[model samples]
Target: MNNIATPEQVTATALLLVGYAAVILFFVVRGALRIKSMADYAVGSVRFSPIAVGLSLAASMTSAATFIINPGFIALYGLSGMLSFGVVMPLASMISLVVFTKGFRKHGQTVKALTLAQWIGSRFQSTGLTRYFGWLSLLLITFIVLICVGLTQVLSNALNAPPLPVLVGIVVFIFGYMMFGGANSMVYTNTIQALLKLVVAVVLLTSGYEHFSQGVHGFLAKLAAIDPALTHATNPQSYLFRDYFEIIFCQIVIGVAIVCQPHLITKSLLLDNERDVNRYLLTAVLVLTVFFSVVFAGLYARLAFPGLQLNGQELKMDKIMSAYVVREFPVYVGLLVIMGLISAGISTLESLIQSLSSTITSDIIKPLLSPTVFSGTGGFRREIWLNRLVITVLGAVAIWLSYDQLLNAKLSVAIFAQNGVYAYFAAAFVPISFGIFLRDAPRLAVTVASVTALLVHFGVYYGRLTPYMQLPVRNPGVSAALGIVAAVVVGGVLYLALHRASVPEKTVAVAA
Candidate 1:
């Protein structure tokens, strides 16, 4: 079952591994000496260089789930899957910049300000509500971290080996450096991993295209011979328009919901200046453009190896590149592909853990321990031990969840870390957007934003409503869109009514 390695493949993989290890070690040493205080642990100081912040932002957004699950989905669906759902990055990132950057970074304040709840708490001037939002975020982030790590096992199966040890081994080694290096470690490691993934994908995909394109007529004939069903998306109706709209609607909801993501937003409030916002945005776009190359290559693989299959499934359409790469490429190329996939997976997983740490410390642990948790924000310069302990607990729980999902519920394999966060964001986007920017938005509007979003996201998702289920285009996105519209209409009317009721009619004439 193994691809018998030549000295070259082994040496290349070994060198790549050694290089990755060195990167991890470098971040680890740097973190141990300089990082302290909960603020430093969570967001790094507000003084992070423009490049570091941009790279860190890119790394945070490109999680292990993107590296692993997206390729698998591509195999199952097509390029349209990412184009339909994953294409929300520009919309999401821009909305994040516009909606949150002003509030978080307007004054260069640095606090744990990681999740949307934190922002809501900060903006509206409420502690109790903030804590509540924080705890909820903690639960979601913890789930995300566990799922991301468990995915390494899927990578193992792709490599044609036992997966548990591989999953656990990598998690431990990565988490060690991750904890010590904090945000810095996670960002730096991801930069290296992002570069590796881009390279491996480019080289491998180019080889595949060149090799397959040699006799297009012949290959086309062979492909048509393999799966005419794939000649075009026959099942597009089953999931296309429905899935497309479902994701889009939810994307709109989640697009603004990014305000809730503490890890992504934590750095926003700490920026040195307003001009840096443009620089950060550019970095995000550049990194994502490179990452999208991987997505395109994966989609193209489906086109190139139309007939390439193992046990009736096309190898190119894998959740992990290791399985497909080994089947599609030579032994030497497969090794590089494996290393690249692992690099992407590990880098994203580290960031997920970091989010988990910040969530628990700020959301669950600190709120319960010290009521006035956000008193000062030169970044999390207070409560070092509290932060680490909470992070450790979060890691332990994630390990347990990963173990359970691996042994008991295999379906957990499909749980994507970012997609779930996207759900959270999508649910909150519209309401939050209005509440923050619209002066006419009353307290009732805030209430509507929060309540309507909750109902649409959880209610439709859980089958509490019949109409949504009966509809042809029922999905998270559609449901979220309906929810956002309803909230806006209701909230707007409520705000208008409340304002009119409070004001004196004669006062207007007196002023005139």
Candidate 2:
């Protein structure tokens, strides 16, 4: 737990953070000036290049989990964790992203949807379902907590500062600017952050090149020498990656559904031109492929901290990457890596704030209050202010939850995040999938499917229905995958039955 960052590193990081803040504010102010309506706030008034939007999507997709947290899991469980997180998951998600983006965007543009809930409501013609999803989006607070904790870990270590003050500063600054900037500022900042992350990814991936002095076999031998389990494809000793079920199957299931999140899937809405979709997807997948490989740096960290101890204190899974950067790199390089790590967290955090607040304002609060309170031309302006207020409230809640996770994570914040975020997308998958792929999607069928997903996901998780969930450090992926499968089955059967029932009615009407 000792501060491994030297004075030079700390000072340089402080200055770099100041510069980062200044640049972010510049964009926020500029973006704020262009905002005249909720639509502008949610999707932006400025025209953005496909490449920039793609980078923003990549940055949003790769959160603190990819850069600062998941790598720690790899460091602990080695190749097994890497396969689940770094390989299988990425491939599944990228494919899912490409598959879902076009259809989702097509409908979204048709409906002029500002949030996922609106998209769902427009697709199924259900206001109740939209409000339901708007409320359900609160579950995303868990993900916000994860990013905050991850950023806190990196900044606290880099600044040689206490975690509490660091956490407070991060919440205030990020949520503050996000209030005004919304999507307009987010895309620009995310693009810059994405570029920085790309540089750091290369630096981190190559940082361990010397470990392969003899060959690839020799590099792995170094791991096996430390522990044979580290070299195994499935680690019997580990909680998450004990077998192919946990390592491969569950990850693929979770990965495909992962794109259903508001921040990730709804990113397609930012592109004004439909023709840019392919280019955007290409940029995101390629950049994300590189970002995902950053998990291998965990192996390098394990090599560096063979005992997983720094200054006689054991390293927490969440702090391993921060410790690795500070200890392994020189002052200047360490500062640069620290900035990249910060960027990784901030990029997604900004997107979450924008998307979630928009949901709360446009989808939830505005709808409920519109008849009485927002029944005029000035309603849009008031709604924009309300969105800012929502961001402020969200910032406060985030501070509370993030501090709790920072202090009392079971294994890592990733688990806490996965439980909530997994359930969200699991529930969302059915409605979104049906809306996109099926022409005559029945509202009742999708609603039943959505509720079933929530029930089954939390049921299997908290009820410990599966052997996987019975473990002390249970895998959320198990519950999420089961939930998605159950939802699809239930929704599909109901849709076919309803479709068949309506077909005979159509035939009778034609005869008449």
TM-score of every prediction relative to native = 0.80, 0.99
| Per-residue alpha-carbon lDDT of candidate 2 for residues 380-451, written as tens digits (9 for 90 to 100) | 777878998999999999999999998899999999999999999999999999999999999999999999
lDDT of each: 0.56, 0.93
Q: Estimate the TM-score for candidate 1.
A: 0.80
lDDT of 1 by residue, 1-512 (tens): 33324455556655766776786797678765667566566655437666666666666665554555555555445534555445664466555655565655642253435555665666555675566566556536533554445355444554444556666666667666666677655656666766777687577547556535657555445445555433342335333323444445555554555544556656555356677877776776677656645654545556545554545663433333444564566766676677666766666566667766666666667767654554566435455556666656665666666666555542224332332454455445543565456655565556656667667655665563644455433344445555656666667777778788768765777888
Give lDDT for model 2.
0.93
> What is the overall TM-score of model 2 with all chains considered together?
0.99
Best by TM-score: 2
